[model samples]
Target chain A: MKVNYFISDIFYVCLRDLKHYLKQRVRIMATLIQPIIWLVLIGNLMSGLTANPLTLKFLDAPSYLDFMAPGVMVMTTLFTGLFAGVRVVWDRRLEILQKMLSTPLSRTAIPLGKIAAAVVQGNIQVIIVLLTALMLGVTFKTGLAGIMVILIFISLFCSIMASISIALSVNIRNMETFFALMNFITMPLMLTSKAMFPVEAMPGWLKFIAEWNPISYAVIPLRTLVTKGWDWTVIWQSLIILCFFALCFLAGAVFFFKRARA
Target chain B: MKNIIEVKSLSKIFPGKITAVNKISFSVKQGEIFGFLGPNGAGKSTTIMMLTTLHLPSSGTAFVSGYEIKKSPRSVRMQFGYVSQDLAVDDRLTGYENLFLQAKYYHIPNQTARERIKILLNLVELEKRAKDLVETYSGGMRKRLDIACGLIHRPKILFLDEPTLGLDIHTRRQIWQYITDLREKQGITIFLTTHYMDEADSLCDRIAIIDHGVIKVLGTPQELKSRLGGDIITLDIALTHVAKIPRLIKLLKTLTNIKQIKTAKTKITIVTLHAESMMADILKIIQKNSIPLEMVMLKTPSLDDVFLNFTGRSLRDEAGNREQAHKARRMLRRIRS
Candidate 1:
């Protein structure tokens, strides 16, 4: 009985969020527009810069757009993951969070539902970007199996980011503070990780910081999967690191939310 | 009647040692409309929060529908519906959608959830606007839907915190009628908290008047009013007879039936079991004293009088002062920063 209620709680919460997301057509357009612009315009512009021999050697890919495709996918996931906190802030401000808490459902179920919806949404967005890349004549070196692995990787990576985002939303008092903190953190995270450029092309100091960034684990494996195809060592390492980040973030969220007054 | 809710010395002290709910205890019978009456900051909402398992108690516990709040919060939560001070419906969702989601959270079977939603929407008279987004609802309509959301799963007890706080007279009456009908039709135990004295007096089977984190008194409205011991008789004296107010109080006090006498500028008020019987004799004394009567009024003691008698201040005055103090504290923090 308890487990059944738990599943239903998660399902209903996720369903509500998804319904809300679909209802706001403007919001859907807004979330999708920025990433498409980055993938089409900026990816092409950056591809021109990587035409030199040193840049070509550093990138190690047949085409710059292909190299940047996975990076753009990872960036899309990161942006989507961070902004997933907006729903938490909205729910809290609007008393939906309180309403859910007053029910018999477990507290963890609420965040899990939100994280699941965000990961699913992020994956869908990533696929859309990938299709857009395909339309622009970008081909993946790997077959369907490798693309499947990358999709799983994006989902796991998004869950971690969504967990952290929701955790911050629970602790922060208002949307202005949440927006400011997310902006300050995401830009630095994206720059320090291998999202925009290859870590091998970076200076030694920058490479060190890039190596430490968790997003690099997600981006590196995705880039490898798209460019070099299936590699057990790469896949396993990325999965383990992503899982570790997800656990830490989820644990942090549950802890802070338990202590949160409302 | 069996007790549907039992609280034992439940308390909630916020951070910085501010006690929002001191060690206060009360219980409610099944199928009864129990009222927690107090001014703002009197801990009514805090008490409801504890009982509904929304906030953990600082020192004690409560049982709702036979489940201990601390030990089995989920079970306690399953046993009660809470209509909080703020509207809890999703503004983005239609009224039916809001209730449907809530029903799902409670794990009610889908078919039953649909039926329950239909029944609840009709009960609250929101069936006509069931398809409209709650953002488009009037204040009263939103409030009605909020209540319907609480009742979606048909819990054993319903907690309504200031259910009619910001409604017009007509809407308030409509909400009250709905509340009474719910109790009559469903036999669901109601636990209501309000600052409205008349609301408590008219609606509750019993009321607990709380103040400063403590319950000052608890009883049926009639019992509470009778505790004040009599009707209140007020005689407003003419300006020329203002000096005779103290003398009038002394004379009124000599009457054995007059239980209490208080004198203010140009007025003398008395509490007596027989205000009508004592009025002539009281007037005779005033006439003999050559003092002109501006106005003489006699009325049965109300819950307001009972509160004033017990708390030494009017409930409305306390509510007003609470707001003022809050503003003053906000200003002081601004100046200090």
Candidate 2:
């Protein structure tokens, strides 16, 4: 009985939240255009620069754009997903949340539905970036299977981030507090993810930090599949960790939000 | 009548400094409109906040439609609807789309939901502008749409906080009539809060006048009025009469049943069971004290009577200034921040 309610509620919320995706054509396009430009213009810009014969040790073997492409895609999703909570803030301000909460909808369904909607929205954006990368001669070495893997990688990554954002937005009462939370949390997670360089070139302490970062988990597995082909052993292990992070973040969010809203 | 709503000693204190809603108890019978009357700071919204499950009470509990608001909030919520004074509609969606969102939220069947949208839009008299985006709506139209949104789910109990606030007189009267019509026709129990004295007088079956987080009087408008009796007499005396009025009022209290006595600056308002009988004796005391009655008028008792009787202040006096209202909102918010 409970599970049925959960599924339907998620379906209902997602179906309706899609209206927002359509409504925010300008804002989404504006936010998404930055990453698209980076993938095409910057990726192409750095392509020739890094393809020189005497390559930097950190960028090793591959061109800079190629090495950086996976990072850019994941980073785009991370920021998009992380800041997705702002929409939830708008909903609270508009009393849409209060309206829904007063009804028979399941309380747990709300955050899950919002996160699911954000994940799908973020994936649409990821696909745009991927297609743009493809246009820029950034072919995936891992074929259709690699694209599938990358999609899963980015989806989980976005889901976890969106879940945190939803939790944060719902729990925090004021905009100022929310901004401060984003600064403390989102900045460090993005910077430490090894998005710019391979862990081999980094100092020992830095390498340890990179290995522990959840953002690193999001990129490395997908990057390996994209650039070098399959690494089955790590892929399965990383998928599990990603699932764990998504669950922990979402559960924490739903639980804390109930208390804060109460 | 079945107790469709029961609130027991509900208390909400903010951060150990502000007591938003003191331990107060009240209940609503099924199929009746209950009005929560208070000035801006009497914790009217806070009590509604607790009842709506938006703010948990520090102590106490409530049951709506046989489900505890805290323990089974979803079930409790399922039985009712809420329209907050803060006009929280989404401007992005068309009026129709917004209704669809609410229908989906309540798990209303799609077919029934469609019919409900049409019915409710018409019920609130917003049928012509249903396709327009809510952002494009006039203040009155948006408010009507909000009312329609609250009712779309066909909740047994509906809560409307300051439902007619900021509306023009015509629209306010229209809504006042519309709400009465809905309750009478649909048999939906309504819990409403308002600062407007007349709205309370005209609409509510029973009212609780609250101030400083405590309920001062709880009774039907007629019952509360009858308690005050015939008419209210206010004496705008010179400063010389300040000291004499209390003793004079005490003597009047002995001779006649003055429901309440409040001295504001240089004016003392006395509401009595017998306005004419008390006037003759009351004037003698003021005249003997060498204080002339600068102004005097006999008027009908209003919800303001209950407020002053309970809180020793008038709701129209702007007792809770805007600064204090925002400050109170922030005090509760600081915890999450």
Candidate 3:
């Protein structure tokens, strides 16, 4: 809540992590390769398969690639977030996290700032994936604002994940334990979300689970933005859920964080 | 005199029924050096977490630089620099970048940030390694960068939690020297915690000894040791003569000049209230007792002795078995998910 300190810590979070990431250019490039492969090889192979089945006459014409695009985008966000939380874990181990925590930076700034950096990184990845998708014949459906739409998707998912990451990072006091729990925590959550498959394709319970998953909201407006044209109803409803998750996650993270000191 | 840091009845408890810190009280005078001395898990780190506004305490309150830790943490953090034991410095970044990031955390203007980073680099003796990735540097070099990062903001007070830990003895000396020099030159109030008695003895003006969530003692190095009211005398009797120690201790305590006596199997140590005349008297008793000693020495009590005397355990012992550290990480992942 302290303006000067929070304002500065946000920049602190971005620049330090960015510089660290920059030095590992090879790793960054490697991480980007996974999503690029999905955009190219998978999009191409699955586009045909997804086309007819993904579209129903009542739902309007939706390309298989288009239907899969948002899912993939959110998947990128999800995967990117998976390790981002670990960055905090790494910070905890190396004592770097202690240095950051001790400074004049806000508790809110630490997580939000890192999340902001992830958003920027996520935006970059989304752009590359979008470009590759475009080359593979995926359309944006909406013109000129493709970049803007990509940024929005990045913010929605990054904010949600960043909040979750910080909350856990503070709580998790060690590294090996974090590794052991990853299967239980991150893997199941990612699989249950509607990232790679349609909600209808899922069984009843799973469909219900997907609907409840926050990532489902991330994909709703995102899929509409990429395919089947933009509809305010789906767009607005998706925005509401995403926003609710963002606020809820952040509030919850801060609250627990406050208790941790106590 | 203004107390730059004020803590009263501060306590923290983990949900798992572990008392990390009990109600403790202390304060730091502006520009003064205050040491928080404790073995690992004595809650030194936990206390620092609360002071720096990183972890919110479950009970009690603290004020730093005139701001309450609970009510105005952001403002409190702004006025201080907190260097931690966790080695927060990123290995990929050069020394300068680390400080630049710290400057950003303090919200320094860009023009000033550049100059401040340069100044801090020189202070930690990393001016030469300022551009190298920390990953390439030795442990000592990385530690220096971490110190430089903490000082970039020109904070009036600095909180250093075990700054010299994990360093070679020589490197520890260098850092100790650097901190003393900085304190004298800039008049920065330094708040530090350490398991190293020599670190507290050499660097701190006063210290608070904590163990098992309690502050057992608080005084200057000289004051704390002096409070025992004697010169510490150690007699290294042979292991075979271990039984002779108890009788010797009884005999030694009977000396008019000696105040307290204790025995540790093969070694008999005594504290003499009248230090000047007591050694000769003590030497006479060993001769009379026919205790052939391997070595005999007398000096002020080190921090280790103070700790062992108080806690009945060594700090190094608690540092063992880090498997639970990994378990803590798993719990972290679960909570996050």
Candidate 4:
């Protein structure tokens, strides 16, 4: 009975957040616009310069748009997941968190519901990015099947980032500090990963850092599936790493959420 | 009635040895509106936080609804609904949806949750606007909706921290009416905290006057007020030498009607049986002694006087000073963390 209550409470928290997402058209628009800009403008500019052998060697896709599609998909997930902290911060300021903590709801269930919502929303955003890439005349080497696999992989990756964000928000006092800290952290996460450029093209030191970055692990498999074709070894390896990453951060969030003072 | 909450030697000490609640002990009877009245930073909120299981006590034990606060927080949480000083309703959601979500948090079944939400909305006179988003609500309506959200789980005890802190007089009274109605109709015990003396005087069945982490007194409004002896005669003094106020107090104590006299820097309050009858004699004594007197007034004794009688300083001044002190402490903690 207690376990059932915990599950249902998590379900309710997810429902509440999803309802807020649907109600706010502005939030949807804001999250979508930034990634689409990077996908179109920068992707086209890089594709136009592909005649240079250096540029050609660095390009992962048949065209710059194809190469950047997976990067944009990963970027979209990271961007949305990092701001997952914003909602938690607002809830804290508004005392909504206090009310939730005062209830019989399980401690882990609250952050679980929030991270789940972000993952679900992350999947939807990636699909839209893929469609936009399709509109820009990009073709997938692994076709529709690859899109489904990449979507699942990106959702798992987003779950990890969202958990980290929630943990940060709970420990940080306010939004101003949260933004300053996330900016310092997320920019490194995005720039160090092989998201925008080929890892082999990076210098030895940068390449070493990219190899250790979790996003690079997920993005490499996504790019390979979108360009190289269906490879079980690559898919399963990335899936395991992504799942491990998600679990680690999920554990962190639960710890912080339990210790969170309302 | 039986006691529903028993706190023994409760205390909370912050990182730098700042004690918010200091070894305070008290018991709240079941089905009564018990008020924790105090100035800001008097540890009223810290006490509420400890009782609600939001903050753990440093060196004490407490039980809410027969469950130990530390041993069984989940059980303690199941019994009480807490309405914090700041409103907590999601503004994006409709009033009905907010209550519906609250019910789900407590694991109430859907059908029964719906019925309870409807009844609560109606009781709070919010059924008409239940479909509207809470952002559209007036301050009073938002507060009512917050209260309704707390009741969605039908908790045995309800904790409200300064429920009417910023509302106008009209809205404050409306909230008061709803509070009394809830206790009368549902038999839910209420525990509230406030600095407003009149609010405690009129609403609380019993009150604990806390200050600087200690309970100064505890009793019904009439009982506490009656402890003042009689009417209050306030005299504002501007002495020529400024050091003769104590001499004036010495002279006032000799008067037959003056039961008690408390002197501040420039004012003296005399608690007496007959302020009207002794006003002339009191003035004559001050004049005979050639002590400068600025003004004099007489009024009935009140909860504020009771607080003054116990704490020496006025509630308003203590609230102002404590707010600044708390802000400084918070800033320092933020920097350290």
Cα lDDT tens digits, model 2, B157-264, are 989988887788999998898789879999999999987888989999998888889888888997897765647888897676567766766766675577788778
Candidate 4 regions with alpha-carbon error over 4 angstroms = A52-54, B232-298, B318-337
Tens-place lDDT per residue, model 4, A1-262, is 8789878878888788889888889878976776678778898888887756766667746787778888889988997788788888888778798788889888899999998888888888898888888888888888888888898898888988899899989867678998998899888889999998788788999999999998898788888888789888988988988888888989998899888676
Per-residue lDDT of B249-272 in model 3, one digit per residue for the tens? 778767786667777767767777
TM-score per candidate:
0.88, 0.86, 0.77, 0.88
Candidate 1: residue pairs that collide = none
Query: By lDDT, highest first, what's the ranking?
Result: 4, 1, 2, 3
* Top lDDT hit: 4
Best model per TM-score: 1
Predicted candidate 1 versus true structure: per-residue lDDT over B229-321, tens digit per residue: 878899898997677777677777788777888778777778888777888998899889998888999999888898888777787775454
Report, to 2 decimal places, the DockQ of model 3: 0.46
Among the numbered candidates, top DockQ falls to: 4
DockQ in order: 0.58, 0.53, 0.46, 0.61
- Model 4 superposed RMSD (Cα): 6.2
Q: Rank the candidates by DockQ, best first.
A: 4, 1, 2, 3
| Candidate 4: tens digits of C-alpha lDDT, residues B1-337 | 8999999999988777888889999999999999998766678878988999888899999989999999999999989999987778899999999998999888888899999998999988999999999999988898899999888888899999889877889999999999999899999999998767889889999999998899999999877887778888898878664687877778778889678888787888888877788999989988988877788889877888888888886776654543474474356435323
Worst 10 residues of 1 chain B by lDDT: B328-337
